[model samples]
Target: MSTDPHANQFGELAWFKSSYSGTSGGDCVEVAATPAAVHVRDSKRPQAASLTISAEQWSAFAAYARQA
Candidate 1:
């Protein structure tokens, strides 16, 4: 939740938004994934703080989300 916005460490990751997000600029979520970790951020605030989690944790969360 605390990566320097100007750092290039995460700049190389290809981030993408959800297809379910509206085109009219409402709330949106974006994601980027590496072999070891997954990154999540608000689409409306790309420069703001983002969240990083392990791939295994993402898998578990995705599974729970699917159930909900």
Candidate 2:
């Protein structure tokens, strides 16, 4: 999805790691949410590019994950 002109960039966003993730940080992703989008990136490489999806899409995926 295309980002709006006013959307928050990666550095400006506040990211969160999953509560279940290990403190030693093996394989996990960090997530950040904005009003219009959800951002996901590897916890090991925060500076790398992230996947951004619409909030609606994220909610749908989250529901599916819960079911899985």
Candidate 3:
């Protein structure tokens, strides 16, 4: 956990790509979840900024995406 929320809080987090993402992929996203927040970033740009959301928000998003 970091003192600054805007910072790359857990740069060492173990990021995982979506199962739907192919190795020959064009675009892909990766996610790293923590008890406090879920971090999302583009797999193509591993050094880029990550979008962080609350655990609750991540849960809601996952549910909605599954329905879609």
Candidate 4:
């Protein structure tokens, strides 16, 4: 969880929110994808620190989530 924007070395990535997100904006996250990594952040606090993981890791996690 690097707070430094430069840590990821990806500049100004476009983030997309989940379609399941509600108007009330409860627990939800927005994700930005790049060739090398996937960035995840709280939709409620877009300016806050984000979690960065490899694209492969994200794909695996997404597959596991689909199973659940």
| Candidate closest to the true structure, highest TM-score | 2
2 or 3: which has the higher TM-score? 2
Better of 1 and 2 by lDDT: 2
lDDT of 4: 0.84
lDDT of each: 0.82, 0.83, 0.81, 0.84
Across 1-68, the per-residue lDDT of candidate 4 in tens digits comes to 66656245565778888777868879999899989999999888888889989999999999999999
Full candidate order by TM-score, most accurate first: 2, 1, 4, 3
Judging by TM-score, tell me the better candidate of 1 and 3.
1
* Model 3: per-residue Cα lDDT over 1-68, one tens digit each: 65443345445677899777878967888898887998898888877788989999999999999999
C-alpha root-mean-square deviation, each candidate: 3.8, 5.1, 3.8, 3.7
Better structure of 1 and 4 per TM-score: 1
Candidate 4, run of 10 with poorest lDDT: 2-11
Higher-scoring candidate on lDDT, 1 or 4? 4
Q: Which candidate tops lDDT? A: 4
Tens-digit lDDT track of model 2 for 1-68 = 33532237444777899889969869999898998899898889887888999999999999999999
Tens digits of per-residue lDDT, candidate 1, 1-68, equal 43656234545667898777869999888898988888899988988888989999999999999999
What residue runs in model 2 are displaced by over 4 Å at the alpha carbon? Answer: 1-11
lDDT, residue 36, candidate 1: 81
